[model samples]
Target: MREYEYHAPLSLERLFELAEAEGMEVRFLAGGTDLMPRISAERNQIPRDRKPPMRIIYLGGLGLDEVTDDGESVTIGATASLSALLDNGAVRTKLPALHEALREMAGVSVRNTATIGGNIMNASPAADSVPPLLVLGAECLLRSAAGERRVALSEFFTGPGKTVARPGELLVSVTVKPGRGGSAFRKLGRRKAETLSVVNAAACVELRDGLCESVRIAVGSAAPVVVRCTGAEQALVGKKIDENSVREAGALVVKALSPIDDIRSSAWYRARVAPTMVARALLAAAERKRG
Candidate 1:
């Protein structure tokens, strides 16, 4: 990596001051799992149009690594490691879809070093955490020198690797409201472990008197951003969780998808399998509710 100045600010005030400093290109360092790799690749560039030197502000000292459950919702601090969330009772018991996604993400070692905020900020369409978080109604808390604001996770991503967060703003935490229903997550990849998703799906369903009371479905790697399948969700509500209803809901999900051909899979293949994945997620969630 190129030479750069590093700052470890003990307070958010110091961090914001460093971020807002005039004329310096600044980046926040959380887990560094993603940032470090990108930084190391800069050395291989031709150097004719190299980017400016980066000023990294380490976020570890700012005490933004806590995970707390306040009965109504669970708030995960931006710097909280993925492994930390997996061990939290609220995450495991109250948010099963997110819990399952975290379990299947990368591997144990990488999870230990990857932060929840980093995963959200990276904003990959195939990111495993996003689909489940979207279905669970997660929100992000962004902070700056001016103040703080909350953005719904569904509305946060504008495109791949992009978000609406203003300049000089830091992602402070992600808060998710737990649902009374059951939820599930499913992923398809080249291999079972340590692989990026080709397509992933998540669903949360509430059942009442053998009928679907409500449902939320989200699919990743099927569009530019992880998206909720509201069409499918609407179709499933008030219907019995049976073969025909599940199949119809699955088919409706394709209307919301606009997948592209990529290194891992083809657009046709994703479209073909996406419906099955969505159906499976819904089936699993419904079974969980019944159990």
Candidate 2:
């Protein structure tokens, strides 16, 4: 890899000061799961017309690695590793779908090194944790030298590998209010595990008096960004969830997807399986809720 200055800031204040410095190509380094690979590729051959970073501001020493609850919401700090998430009881109990996604994300080694912030900030449409988090109505907390701001997770991504966060802004944490019902995440990949998703779906439903009071359905890797199946969710509300309703709602999910033919799968395959995955996720979620 090309030699670059690495600064391990002692505090958030020091991190901000370094980020604000003018005319320097600065990339915030967290987890090193994604950044290391990219850096190695750049060293071998720089991307055409792309500017190389002058420095990497490592956040490991800054202590932004905690998972805590504030009664209503769970805040996952940017530096909190996936292994840390697997051990948090509150996260597992309150956000079962997210827990499931994390458990299946990758093997033990990758999970130990990959942070939640890196996963979100990578902004991949196929990110395993995103659809689950999206269905939970999560929000991202961003900080810069100036101040901090909160952006709904649904609004965070503009496109694949792109987000609304500015160059100087650092993603600090992700926040989500616990939902009342059980949820499920389903992913389709080239392999059974340790692979990128070709299509993935998640469902969250709150049942009251045997009727769906509230519902959220999100699909990923089938669109430019992870998307909520609002029409399908609307159809599920106030209705008893059954095989027929689920099948119909699943059709609506297929209608909502805009999958493209990629190396992982064909658009036809994704379009066909999207509804099936949605149905399966919903059914699994309902079963979990009843249990």
Candidate 3:
């Protein structure tokens, strides 16, 4: 790895100051699970170009690792480890979809070090946490020296590895209101453990007297960004959720996706399996709602 300056700022102010320091290229370090591998790959570039020495700001000291449930909403600090969230009672009971996503992510060791902020900021379409967050109606809280702002998680990502966050901004936390419905997450990968998702899906359903009262569906790895299947959601809302209705709604998911062929799977394969994955998630969510 290339030599870089490392700083562990104890406060957000110090972080911003370090970020604004001229002549130094600044990169924030959360869990380093994703950033470290990418940095190591840079060493193998055939034609290495001269670049500014990087300054790595470690976020651990900034106290951004708390998980709080305020009855109305659950706010998860960005730097909180995936394992920490998995152990939270509010997450397991109130956010089962997210809990399942965390459980299926990587393995125990990786989860101990991987941060939710890093996962979201990485902005991978196949990110395990994103689909559930999208379905749960989560919001990202971004902070900077100037001020702070909140962006809907569904609207956060512009494309792979891209978000609306401005330069000098840091994602502070994510907030999601606990819903009175059931939500589920499903991931399709090459194997079961420690595999990147070929297609992943999440669904939230609220039933009233055996009729779907509200619904949300999101599919990952099927588009440039994780996307909500609004058309499918509209079709399912106010309708009875049965095998046929669920299957029909799942079909609508394909219309919103523009998948691409990659190492894990092909565009055709993704397109084929995405609908079924979504259908399964919806069915599971509906069953949970019934219970």
Candidate 4:
């Protein structure tokens, strides 16, 4: 790494002013989990107008930490640490699917250092938080000196490592309405822990009379952006839970995914495994409903 000037902005306004003024030359310093690696990686170096890469605007000092529930919705601050989410009782009870993914993310040391905002901002295709958030139908609050804007979680990502957030905007927090439905998150990785996902999925199902009243399914690492499987969801709407209904829904999910061949797994393999994963998630959600 090269020496660079660091600015510790206490609030969102200051952060936006710096970012808008600096433009592409300025980078937000959230957890530094993704930022540091991009700078030091031997294969691809940060495009520096000079030697030190770019200036970092540190977000660590910002007083943005909060997790609140008003019984209507939950607002999670962008700066909230992954470690904090894992230990939060309200999160475990209310958003168990999301919390389960957070707890299973990387390892204790890495989870300690990674921030939820960083994860969303980086816009990684395989990010652990994306699928769960997508399934929950969360909304992100993006703030800049100009104003604050809110976007649905499904509309957040434009591409891998890219977001619709403007140059001056910083993600302030994410909000999700409390649901009475059961949800599940499942991923198939190269190994158990700390490995990037090859196929990952999350689903939320509102059950009535042992049939799906409403359904939302999201899959990651299978496309340029995290995808919401509306086709699969439509298939399950008002359909009774059975082997045939489940199998048909799973097939629709497989067809909806845009899996590509990669070193981690082949497109064929991803296609085969995706439906099974979705099936598994459905079963898990059903179990939650029963319990």
Best by lDDT: 3
Tens digit of lDDT per residue, candidate 1, span 1-291? Answer: 345779999999888988985656788899988898987777666566646677899999998999899899999999999899999898999988999999989999999999999999988999999999998899999999999999999999999999998778999999999768889999998899888999999999999998999999999998999999999999988999877898998899999999999899999999989999999999988988998
Off by over 4 Å in 1: 1-3
Native-to-model Cα distance after best TM-score fit, residue 237 in candidate 4, in Å = 1.1
Higher-ranked by lDDT: 1 or 2: 1
Which residue ranges in model 4 land beyond 4 Å of their true spot? 1-3, 22-24, 42-53
Pairs in clash, predicted candidate 1: none
Give the TM-scores of the predictions, in the order they appear: 0.97, 0.95, 0.97, 0.93
What lDDT score is found at residue 126 in candidate 3?
93
Order the numbered candidates by TM-score, best leading. 3, 1, 2, 4
RMSD of each: 1.3, 1.6, 1.2, 2.2
Roughly what TM-score does model 2 have, to 2 decimal places?
Answer: 0.95
What's model 4's lDDT at 144? 83
What C-alpha lDDT values do all the predictions have? 0.91, 0.89, 0.92, 0.84
- Worst 10-residue lDDT window for candidate 3 reads 43-52
> What range of 10 consecutive residues in model 2 has the weakest lDDT sum?
46-55
Candidate 2 lDDT over residue span 1-291, tens digit each: 344778999988888888875666888888888889988878789556656447799989978898889889999999899989989988888988899888888778989999999999999999989999998889999999889999999999999999999987999999989768879999888887688998899999889888888899999999999999999999999988889999999989977789999899999999999998899889888877888
Off by over 4 Å in 3: 1-3, 44-47
Q: In angstroms, give how far residue 183 of model 2 lies from its true place.
A: 1.3
Give the per-residue lDDT of model 3 (tens digit) for 1-291. Answer: 355899999988889988886776788999999998887777667536677778889999989999999998999999999999999999999999999899999988999999999999999999999999999999999999999999999889999999998877999999999689899999999998888899999999999999999999999998999999999999998899889999999889999999999999999999999999999999998988898
The candidate with the higher lDDT, 3 or 4, is 3
